[model samples]
Target chain A: MNTLKDKATFKQAFIDTLPVMSGYLIMGAGFGMVMNSYGYPPYLSTLMAVCIYAGAMQYVGANLLFTGVSLFSVALTTFIVNARHIFYGLTMLEQYKKAGKEKPYLYFGLTDETYTLLSRPLSVKNKRAYRFYVTILNHSYWIAGCTLGALLGSAFPQVRGADFALTALFVVALVQSLEFHKRNDLPALIGAGATLLSLLIFGKDNFLLPAMGVIVALLLLLPEKEAKA
Target chain B: MTTHTYLAIAMIALVTALLRFLPALLFSRMERTPRFVIRLGQDLPKAALGMLVVYCLKDLDFTSLQGYLPATVACVLAVFSYATKKSSLFSVLLSTIAYMLIMNLFF
Candidate 1:
């Protein structure tokens, strides 16, 4: 038994995830409160938290739900919002290949936080249990927060401007990505410019797909060295 | 939940799960994928984050300082706070609380 791996138990997983516990609970509660303020039920909140476990999309979803947007819009926008998970899955393909019975749920729950936690290099005896428990615990924390927030929201509705947290969260993500890739802001710049251009042409409600299309076309056009770099 | 609502939730879940599932299924099964596709995946995330940041701010009245006051201030605060404090929780909490106060007091 390697001492380094630490036998990744539920206790270890729980301890490892303590930081995420605070983060998830607060964010989840915020999402729940927003949904509740939109007059969504508690069950709906938990159900979304369980199924559509992507935090950013779920946060954006409250707006979608409130507006009662078209199903096509919901499907298309969500694909773009959570599209980064494709990269995550690319890296995780080998590791998750070992997920076996837990594979489907593993893929379903591979939210950003879970991807970060699971992708850490951990030498373990049973990698499956380690990954599985962490995934389950994280999902449960989110569900708990969402459910509580929905209940509170159902009790007292009118909490406007709380959705600003969504913008804040997006900024944090953008900054984090920017800081990580200091020299290569070209792609990022292209994305922003392309999106704004598309939005101007297509209008906000119909701009997402076109914006993503432009981003993809431009990204693919980058030289191999520049793109990979 | 209404039947319509349930359908929306289910559709999102199914679509999102499929997004995560496709690469795992495709790359593992196929012997060759285009170099450009892999490169795009490598580079897309940072760019996508940038796109999303713009998308979030797109609705704001960015043409003037006053029309976009609270949101602009909060976004700048969030970015700067994150730079110094290096804590997402603090940045998010501070900017959000600051935005709420500014909106109520001034806006």
Candidate 2:
């Protein structure tokens, strides 16, 4: 493949990702631990880290797999959970179009952290290499963290309540979503209401899909807000 | 892992990658992103993430204090920590510990 030989860009990329490294390692390990606690293999967690790199979705996906949830629900949940990436891709279209050989990977590896880092103007001589290295470094930190957590989980399989990490994760996301998105109140209310209603109606074993349906239906019917300049 | 599980993971990965890739592929040739998609992108996440929070708490038993108290306290802690510190790691870590302690000690 294309060898990115610029050490300067790589160094800059590495430094930029140091914060993400700590977060990814801890979060990825938590994902791995959760999966391992459910009796899945470490390789499975590693595979997820490689294939599906989204942290929130990985935790959700592991729960789905463990529960033997239907494939349709899996796809639907993934789409809803990851829908934000569409906007991220929209914003990056111009930059990635010129990415050449790295276009596909750069697109695939565009997690939230990588996208945030790349959105900033870079001082490196090779912007392309910087972009690629940033993506690669963030990805590697995630994989390493997953592997490390899976091994640790296996060593101490008695660790109860690790699965609560999933709840904490979604909680953090919900908090951040509310914090940043000023107009998020109505939609958030619709979401919680629809989900609680579904759970009560459909019971514990199967409420997610219907809850998602109601949320989507309700949100779509609402008038679109005026576009910002 | 079972083949079914692998299939499910593949589906998740495919959909996620496609979501990230489709905008670039479709919109590169278009003048501007469709208003419908843009609106959905902004509004859907808030709703979906809120749904996820409720989904996570679905199993909490309301009839008994033990079943629901820990989760309630932990969730409140999570929200408070994230709102104040804005550190996802610290919030998640702190709330999870609080959850484990409550679950082990009381319920």
Candidate 3:
């Protein structure tokens, strides 16, 4: 009955999940409150959290929910927004395969936060169990937070500057990456330049696709030149 | 739920999962799946992080001080905070809090 029986493994995983758990709960609740504003009930928000499992996308989804957009747009937007996960999956192939039976769910649940944590690859005795527990724990926190947000949204409908946290998040990750691995500076500069150019050309609503396209193109086209030089 | 609701959920879920899995599935069997693709994966994070930060400020109005000052200040705060702690968590937390307070109080 208890496949997650190892007390030590569970404890370690829980400890690892603690910081993100609190963050997710708060963020999830913020999302839930937004959904509540959109006239969705708590159960539906919970369902979205459980099924969709992408925090930023769900926030965008809530915005799109009431806009009466076509289903095709929803799907397209979903892909564009979460396309970053594809890079995460590719980068994680070496480590994810090690998760064994947990690979499927690990693949399915690799949200931005989970991918960030796992990208560094924690040094744990039970890597498989740790990955699984971390994924599931993150999911649970999200679900719980969304549900709470929904329930409380009616009372607190406003969350100002909350979305800024996402940008701040990227900053934090970029800083950490730069600190630990200095080699990323070139790509970071390229990415920043391409994104700024694309944003100027594409506009906010349409910039992501072009930015990603530019990143891949630059990475593909520029590296050989540098290597030879 | 209506047909569209069900369809939306199924489509979004299916597309997202497939995307996340596509890379692994492509590379799982072959030891080498083009050096460029591997390098792209290696370098993508840094670029992606940069893009994401710009993406956040997409809505800010650079023409006006009120529109841009808070984020600018907070980013500086985050940079200084990261310089000291060298921890992403603290930098984000402090910068985000700084942004939130500034937004709530002034903007």
Candidate 4:
């Protein structure tokens, strides 16, 4: 009975993460379609979805790989692009510490969606289990979607205009994030401004890194008075 | 594409996994993290989000920021909708529709 109860809990946790899971599925499929169109085999794209698990970066990397960019440049770019994740893990320290043997996989599964879901408030009994489930479920959805797209690509002569789905997903994420943290529009405004400024200064090809750099620096330096709970 | 490319990808994956997993493992052993570290962690998401927002607008032609006037209007609508505590999905849908209409009609 105890084991059965645990199983039910895990199942529920997985179900709870379905919203984010579906989002990943759609985005991953978009990526897979793009990769297929790029002349890479479907299986390789599926493998990448499972292994690298960085959605947007993978899309960018695919273009770079196709262009035969240097491995060193790719590595450097990825490092800079994902540098913010280092700080994400810092916030999750306490929650992850309690994951015990499953800790490794928990860390491995920390994508943007997983991180967002895990950071939400939940009951004590469900917290750790939910985090684990969200991590696994998000990954599973992405991998499954990539595989499905690969298999379907052969049948569809051309899978065009799929990349726009990423833009839609980002819009959804931005709206959700804004909704979650009410009464504070500073971050959003700052991000929009910094991004526009950076784009103007650095140009399209080079804007992301500088925009992110400025945002991170400002966030680190900004002083905030503690909110009264 | 080549054997070397596969090897390089595998190496990147290995290093990424290590960087991602190591922090969770090491920090989980500690009973408490420093306050500054905790604060930093809390702020990271906001910073990351800022970066993503910038990424979304990176390709816009500011010289014709006028061309994207509808998107700008939609952004303002989204802000007001959010401030009023309206549903996020509704705000996104409405704004998107508005932007599309403006683009189709004007540009």
What DockQ does model 2 achieve? 0.45
Model 1 chain A worst lDDT run, 10 consecutive residues: A1-10
Model 2 regions lying over 4 Å from their true place: A1-45, A52-142, A149-153, A157-159, A162-166, A179-184, A204-206, A226-229, B1-16, B19-28, B63-66, B81-90
lDDT of 1 by residue, B19-105 (tens): 888777787676665576566665666666667677778888867665699998999999999999977667877887888788777
Which rank order by DockQ, best down to worst?
A: 3, 1, 2, 4
| Colliding residue pairs in candidate 2 | none
iRMSD, model 4, in Å: 4.0
- Give lDDT tens digits, candidate 3, residues A46-83: 88888888887888877777675798898899989888
> Cα deviation of A102 in candidate 4 (Å)?
2.7
For model 1, state the Cα shift of residue A51 in Å.
Answer: 1.7
lDDT string for model 3 (B1-107, tens) is 45666567666777788888988888878866667666776777777677767766777797988889999898888878988887666777788788889999986
> For every candidate, how close is chain A to the native chain A in TM-score?
0.67, 0.68, 0.80, 0.75
lDDT (Cα, tens digit) per residue for candidate 2, span B58-100: 7788899987898899889998988789876688778878888
Best by TM-score: 3
Give the per-residue lDDT digits (tens) of candidate 4, residues A7-99. 666876765555555556666776777788888888888888889887767777677677777778777767765654565576677666656
lDDT of each: 0.74, 0.78, 0.76, 0.64
Off by over 4 Å in 3: A1-23, A63-70, A121-130, A156-159, A162-164, A179-183, A224-229, B31-33
Clashing residue pairs for model 3: A33-A149
